[model samples]
Target: MDMREFAGSSFITVESLRAGPREEVVVSVAPGKYDKPVATFKSGDQLTLNKTNVRTLIKAYGEDSRDWVGCSIELSIGPTKYDGDQIESVVVKPISPPKPLAARTPVPKPPPPKNDMNDDAAAF
Candidate 1:
């Protein structure tokens, strides 16, 4: 059985930053592979993405786990070196968007047709 599952909370560290009198930000650090948190994949009853995978995803994405909450990273299996030994491992990669989002231009509305106003308009 893998142990990283149980080691999650153990290795993670949380820090609180005061931003205002009543506002604060909490930072949580989890086991990461590259420079990012390892991405966890849940199966029927198993979970994948170990420390290495988390680091790779962190590197592919970013170091801050909060920022990665809604981000996407691609993973692949490849050979990696560890302590002078080569072993197959999962790696995370960043995918570039086809194009950047462009600013939307508002459509010009046609000016109201010119018409004369009659004082009887209030009777309606």
Candidate 2:
């Protein structure tokens, strides 16, 4: 089975989030919102956030998801230690607000010839 459909890339957006019953946090991963949808992740695909990723999210978007309604989270699958066994787990990368692009001046275009005739050729 493709793990990407679960959580394996930087194409997840915080659709809605809430603290789970215990230490877990339920996060709805919605692709195609902030980034392109890969594999098959619907609008409300469930993704239980790992503790490490959750803490990272809190660091980036703050604890309350109300402050992160439309924030982007870059996640990827990587090696992680779990229960003394090495395993591939969903990883969270640093997330920061996008910076503004530098303003560019519009290039001037040469005006079209007054007449539609070829400049080098005379009308016959």
Candidate 3:
């Protein structure tokens, strides 16, 4: 059997969502599965973009899906109602700015080598 049998769904699933939010790099965004726009990740999982996901991605990256490639997004499970039943769904966490680098400690230079020759040496 192939991965499809093991994976069940080629798309990301709520049950597969990690305990903590995980960042995934976008590999490509294109029509997949049912001719709907899907965001494929470097992790090899694909997420079919719903209206909420589409809006979130647009707000984070831009209107152009092409620009979304190579960008990162945090995924988590959130509550949603489907068919009058509460269910967990994959939600894209809001994008946050990268933290600034901490100040580096300056390395001290070594003292210059001492002159080995004595001052009494004859001038040539």
Between the candidate structures 1 and 3, which one is better when assessed by lDDT?
Answer: 3
List CA RMSD, all candidates: 18.9, 17.9, 19.0
Worst 10 residues of 2 by lDDT: 15-24
List runs of model 1 lying over 4 Å from the truth. 1-38, 41-60, 96-124
The model with the greatest TM-score is 3
Q: 32-115, model 1: which lDDT tens digit per residue?
A: 555543333331111135566556544544444544443344444556777899876544444422121232223357899977
Off by over 4 Å in 2: 1-42, 94-124
Lowest-sum lDDT 10-residue window in model 1: 12-21
TM-score of each: 0.35, 0.41, 0.60
Cα lDDT computed for each candidate against the true fold? 0.41, 0.46, 0.72
lDDT of 2 by residue, 1-124 (tens): 8565576434233323222111222344334333422222233344545666666655665544444344555555666777999876656554445222332223347898798677797679
Q: Compare candidates 1 and 2 on lDDT and give the better one.
A: 2
- Measured by lDDT, the strongest candidate is 3
lDDT of 3: 0.72
Measured on C-alpha atoms, candidate 2 has an lDDT of 0.46
Give the candidates in order of TM-score, highest first.
3, 2, 1
